[model samples]
Target: MTAESDPWAAHARRTVGGPRPLLTEALELLGRPRRRVALDLGCGAGNDTLALLERGWTVTALDGSAGALALVQERAGVHRTRLTPLEAGFHQVPRRRYTLVYASLSLPFTPPARWDRTWRAVRRAVGVRGWFAATLFGPRDGWAGEPDMSFITAQALRERLDGFEPVVLREWEGEIRLAAGGLHPSHTLTVIARRLSR
Candidate 1:
């Protein structure tokens, strides 16, 4: 599909406002990392990537859409030197250690069959003491029944972070604004956890 018509592209355009609260809270908890490196998984439109760059972080912004990556680079401007844009899908994510791995409102898009593998890659990408912040959809979300997407209960999500120390774990169920510009019933889990062990 064309970039103008792609739903993801449209979503990216709408979400360029600022970084999410999960990321800000995670950064506050993390303080100054030994290494100022971060991986912006599914960095739609580079909103979070720009936030990290402004804080002097070397960011790797990964998105499946080339158009999205272009937008990231464009928005980065002078911060482009610190930004590494990678165009790849969740299943194609490489295992690379980083001080922080942030995936906002993206993991749920992974197909159920690829969820385990993708989650493993994401987990391994976090170095010891590193932080991970993400927003995951719950089974009650409007898209939960779709076979191409993955949804988890709050308890199950916590179980998956076996080696991580929970910093911020919040779950909410109510009407949420959609990327395409409307309201919908949604259940989401937002987490910022620190990896305690390898």
Candidate 2:
């Protein structure tokens, strides 16, 4: 199913566009790990997916938006066999394991009430010694209390990822202007975790 048929295509379009700093950092960290299979959750616009491909990663780009996939399909130099586009939400991904999983600026959209369950699914999807890079909104973020968004305290987030070793925990706080228009002060927490075991 393409992103055009998906109802959330517009929202995804507004959510992501260009390359993000966290995406660059993730690529740097993956160089030594030699990650081949990657899952780019909420890969809107394919910026991150294309980045992964350039890094020689075989990617499964998942987004609930069909427009997002269209954007990916239009990207140059990426082979069709190297990239698999799946228009699916976090909850509906096919059960499988990945060597690397990046969910940039996407976890906040998960329903708070089920955030833990969703996290568990993410944890399960990343294989042993796999790398997981994701962006999560913090309590100080303006969108914290917004509907369908999940925000957690630093301590709470630390506890949630107790089983994994956190390689990077950079707290980003500043005002960002969206391309669509509007500025909001954001408190973003970027986490890079390595799954050592179950």
Candidate 3:
């Protein structure tokens, strides 16, 4: 696919920024005092990865694009020692435990056929009382039915959060202006839940 047609490329170009607001808010709400190991799933451009590193967390930033991973590594600069950049798609996430498993605006991009396994992998990667923060697309999202993507309703989402004690579960819908000067509607569920003791 062409650069414009590839969602990962498009997002990498526009991912310049500090930590996402949702991430910052989630951390504030959790109030966890210790630095934790983090897995930044689909870490496009490393915005969230940088945030985690700044807070003294060891981070494994994984993405499907080699270019994206390169950018993340470059952004890590002197802190590269704490950042482990890996090139892998959703289905290839390695088996590992983490104190924080974060996926921001990326989980929905998992191909439908592999989503079940990916979800299971995601859950298994979290350590006891660890945090899981992510942005999941809702059924009303403009990309709801896009191929290779997944969207869930509020009720279904609740069912999936069974092992996580919710710290923040917020739903939002609005129009987002694209870099192409077009508008796209978005409906998303932002979650910041702590895993229950297992």
Per-candidate Cα lDDT values, in order, are: 0.89, 0.80, 0.85
lDDT of 2: 0.80
Cα distance off (Å), candidate 1, residue 178: 1.6
Q: Assess every candidate by TM-score.
A: 0.95, 0.88, 0.92
* lDDT per residue (tens digit) for residues 1-198 in model 2: 544566466655665556788878876776656558989988887888887777677889988777768768777254666998897778665578898889988888988777877888888888888889998888899887787888877777788886788889888889988655899889988899888887
* Model 3, span 128-194: residue lDDT tens: 8888999999999998889989998888888988978988888999999865578999999988988
Per-residue lDDT of 92 in model 1: 73
Candidate 3 deviant stretches above 4 angstroms: 1-7
Best by TM-score: 1
Question: Which regions in candidate 2 have their CA more than 4 angstroms from the true location?
Answer: 1-18, 76-78
**Candidate no. 2 TM-score:** 0.88
Best by lDDT: 1
Judged by lDDT against the true structure, how good is candidate 3?
0.85
Scored against the true structure, residue 119 in model 3 reaches a CA lDDT of: 88
User: Model 1, which residues run further than 4 Å from truth?
Assistant: none
